[model samples]
Structures are given as C-alpha cells and as structure tokens.
Target: MTQQNPGSAPDEESPAGDPWHAFGYLVAGVAMYGFLGWLADRWLGTSFLVVLGILLGAGLGLYMTFARFNRPPDPQSKQEKN
Candidate 1:
C-alpha cells in the first residue's frame, strides 16, 4: 500500500481549501452587492441602500459558503472508489 505524507491531505479534506473558498465567497459577495447598493443609493439619493446591500451580500456569501462546503458525500462516488 502506498503511504500518505504526514503533512498531506486529500483534496476533498484538504485544510487549505475551505477557508479560502469561504473567504472568497464572502468578500466577492460583499464587494459586488456593496457596489450595487452604492449605485442604487447614488441614483436614489439615499444612504441606507449601501448598508442593506452589504448585509444582503454577507448573508448570501454565508449561504453560498455553507452550501458549498457542507455538502453530503455522494454514496455512489464512495461505492465506486471502494
């Protein structure tokens, strides 16, 4: 049997994968929505849309992060591996 490296992990279970993905989702969501909100605020001459946009972005980001990283493993794939 081949041995795994002590410091190595499979891609699925890799420690370096999830945090960066989550952070990217969050930052991208916030940046995108925040920009939209700022634009809306500017157009409407209002100040609250930016905050609302940021909140919405953050919520969506969290949702995406959870959805992506919290998935259940596929039984078919497991069986195939075995």
Candidate 2:
C-alpha cells in the first residue's frame, strides 16, 4: 500500500550538484591555503611560501574533488534499494 514517487530516489544527483560542490571545495581550499601561506610569509619574512601554499592547496583540492566525484556509486546501496 505504499507508493513511491518516481522521482524521489535519494541516490540521484541533482544536475547542478557535483560541479557546484567541486567548485566550492576548490575555491575554499585555495583561499584558505593561500591565506595561511600569506601569514607564514609575513611572519617569516619570506617571499615564496604564499605561492607554494596556493599550489599545494590547488593540487590537494583537485585530488579530493576527483576522488570523491569520479568514483562509481556503492553496489550495496543499489542492492538495498531493491
């Protein structure tokens, strides 16, 4: 007697979900790392740490984004739905 809405699956990704989420992650990572690097440069009187931090942040962000978004969905979840 229970009816499920055809469009109500929780596993479905909205059309704008992944890309926007990835973009937000990348921007936040870059800004946070860059700010930390800038602080380090100010404290240590060095000129290179800001650039390094930005690069490291970008690399890490990209790695995280791809790792999270590019993987296939879990097989167990699919089976459980049925």
Candidate 3:
C-alpha cells in the first residue's frame, strides 16, 4: 500500500513554476538575438541584418511564450494527499 500526502499529485497547479522559467528563457533568447544583431551590424556594417535579427528574435520569443501557456502544470511539486 502507498501512502499519499496532502496536496500531492502527479499533476498540480503551480503558478510559480513554468511562468518564471519561461520568462527567463524569453529574456535570455531576446538578449542573445540582440547580441547577434549587434555583432552582425558591427561586422557587416548594415542595419538590415540587425532588423532581421530583431524579427527572428521576436518571433521566437512569442513562440516560447505561447508554448509555455500550452504546457501542463508541474508534476514534481504536486501535493498528492490532503
């Protein structure tokens, strides 16, 4: 027989889990894209490259944001037994 703990479940709602991780990921991605754009502009001496970088970065960031919302609640922190 297995003993279950309160609020412990394989699937639980945690507001502090995925949102923070997803935000961090989004920030890092944006920063990376910005850096790449700066590098491209510095090396190529063209602003178009930077613009492209921004567009790509924004697209990727939005994708990640949407993906995070689609994911299920955290399983590790779920409290099973009440």
Top TM-score prediction, candidate number: 1
lDDT of 2: 0.81
List clashing residue pairs in candidate 1: none
lDDT of 2 by residue, 5-71 (tens): 5776756644424688788878888998999999999999999999998998888889888887777
Candidate 1's displacement at residue 14, Å, is 6.9
Candidate 1 lDDT tens digits, 1-82: 7555566453444343458889999999999999999999999999999999999999999999989877787686465445
Q: List the residue pairs that clash in candidate 3.
A: 5-81, 6-81, 6-82, 7-79, 7-80, 8-79, 8-80, 9-79, 9-80
lDDT of 3 by residue, 1-82 (tens): 7765666464454463467777776777777887899898999898877677777787798787777777775565444422
Model 2 regions lying over 4 Å from their true place = 1-7, 10-17
Sort all candidates by TM-score, best to worst: 1, 2, 3
lDDT, candidate 3, at 20: 73
Of the candidates numbered 1 and 2, which has the greater lDDT value?
1
What's every prediction's RMSD, in angstroms? Answer: 4.7, 3.4, 4.7
Ranking by lDDT: 1, 2, 3
TM-score (C-alpha, index-matched) for candidate 2: 0.74
